[model samples]
Target: MHQADMKLCLVLLILLFVTLPAQADNAWQAWREGKALLLMRHTLAPGSGDPAGFVLEDCSTQRNLNNEGQQQAKRWGKLLRQQHNGEITVYSSQWCRCLDTARLMDLTTPTPLPVLNSFFAGRGDGDKQTQALMQQFAIAQTAQPTVLVTHQVNFTALTGIFPRSGEAAILALPLTQPATVLARINTP
Candidate 1:
């Protein structure tokens, strides 16, 4: 074969043999294998903070998700179910936006977790809350992928990563050890 033709064939072989395998071995695979925690910030709420008289039980009083945010949440749910074959566990903060996002998902109903609640806007104890979440993550079984729908502050406090609205951070569990970020699933 000609030298140029041989080089072209070699390049194709490298792409198929080396690059393909690396692409196939993504962080999603680790999440699918139950080795990571999917930490998701709630979708766009259309405001910086809640209103003056915000109430946890009443969504209208809080900075709720706008139409676009609702659609974003649904799309994420669809993508997650499609990718994981409908195997997922969703835990969410009690905040209206977080709960709405979780409920819109196709996964299991989100159990209200105070630990997952946002500390932003002076809502609660940031340090204690983050520690509580870490403790649960450290001991909980990881046989099935777990999704935590929370806020930016909670995520930052736990993983020191500030995810964008509707974004997700894949964190390796066992809080006693140094945290490892496996992936960052951006908005769809």
Candidate 2:
């Protein structure tokens, strides 16, 4: 290879190694700080929420996390296990996708909170409940880090940001400060 081409290849290799590890370190640091609140937007499920004829009680009537989503959730759980040594509380929306994803984590049996449900439905009560949940979370005194698994709309409503699937947003609560986009984990 030409000297210039070799130099370019070296630069590319250096960037690939340096940049990727830096991102991973940042993510791990965020997890360590406990100032980070990992808010996930469920896993891969092409559509958002359920269709017009959806039924809340029956998951079959809803647009749930598919096989890929399940795997992604499991992968996320593994990552958390490897990264965080501290105790982490896991919460999820009542929806099937959130519930399934939370379960797949296998880290903790998630507590189902209605407040974590989607705000996309534009339900006034849901919004009120969500706000209440946030307030509670903000005030609670827990030593362990907490993770909330909900929909993009709900995550956005809480932190004023939309999180992609399998992506986690870290929020500093109590003051309700701006949240940081941690990492987007692809389980596939």
Candidate 3:
């Protein structure tokens, strides 16, 4: 990344942390009512992007989650279990880090959704992926709580919020154009 762009990203991260949401109740309430869609970035994987010769089919070729990330994911799962009772459909990106994060949560066998896949290495069209994600539940998967475990780029494309790893944005229903921002969560 360019120095200037890197600095800008750092600034944004600082701002997001500084403005972390205080109304945890409201965010939980939306979840309890099954009126929100959670879009979360996968937990920490040490570095920024995948290494050279990054292969999608091989976990060793990707950035997998670290021990700290594993702990964070487990904590989130326990917390979610405490907060929302009933089934939670977890949709994960095809990336190893994302899949592992979702699996560690144990929130259900996370269904791999292509649209939730990271568009970071020019792998997919961000705009198109965002649209597909929004339309994914237009007819079904609306009655239950759904969580999309994905990458920072997917969340940014959908909500214009550059979410930190392990951060989440709870979007209001009908996740189409101009989706509502219900809450922002920095999960453990």
Query: Which has the better TM-score: candidate 1, or candidate 2?
Result: 1
lDDT of 3 at 78: 85
Residues 1-188 of candidate 1: C-alpha lDDT, one tens digit per residue: 99999999999998888865454356677778787778899998887868999888988899999898999999988988876985688999999999999988767788999988878877899888877888888853497878999998887787777778999877776653335776667887
Candidate 2 backbone clash number:
0
Q: In model 1, where do residues sit more than 4 Å from their true spots? A: 1-25, 176-178
Give the 10-residue window scoring lowest on summed lDDT in candidate 1: 19-28
Candidate 3, which segments miss by more than 4 Å at Cα? Answer: 1-23, 139-141
TM-score against truth, every candidate = 0.83, 0.75, 0.83
- Give the per-residue lDDT of model 3 (tens digit) for 1-188: 99999999999998877665545567677766767787889988899878998998999999899999999899878878887779998999999999999999988999999999889878889888888888775642367788889998888877888888888878877786656677878867
Q: Supply candidate 2's per-residue lDDT for 88.
A: 76
Model 1 scores a C-alpha lDDT of 0.82
By lDDT: ranked, best first: 3, 1, 2
Model 2, position 110, has a per-residue lDDT of 96
RMSD of each: 4.9, 4.3, 8.4
User: What is the lDDT for 44 in model 3?
Assistant: 81
C-alpha lDDT of all candidate models, in order: 0.82, 0.74, 0.84
Clashes of 3: 0
User: How well does model 3 score by local distance difference test?
Assistant: 0.84
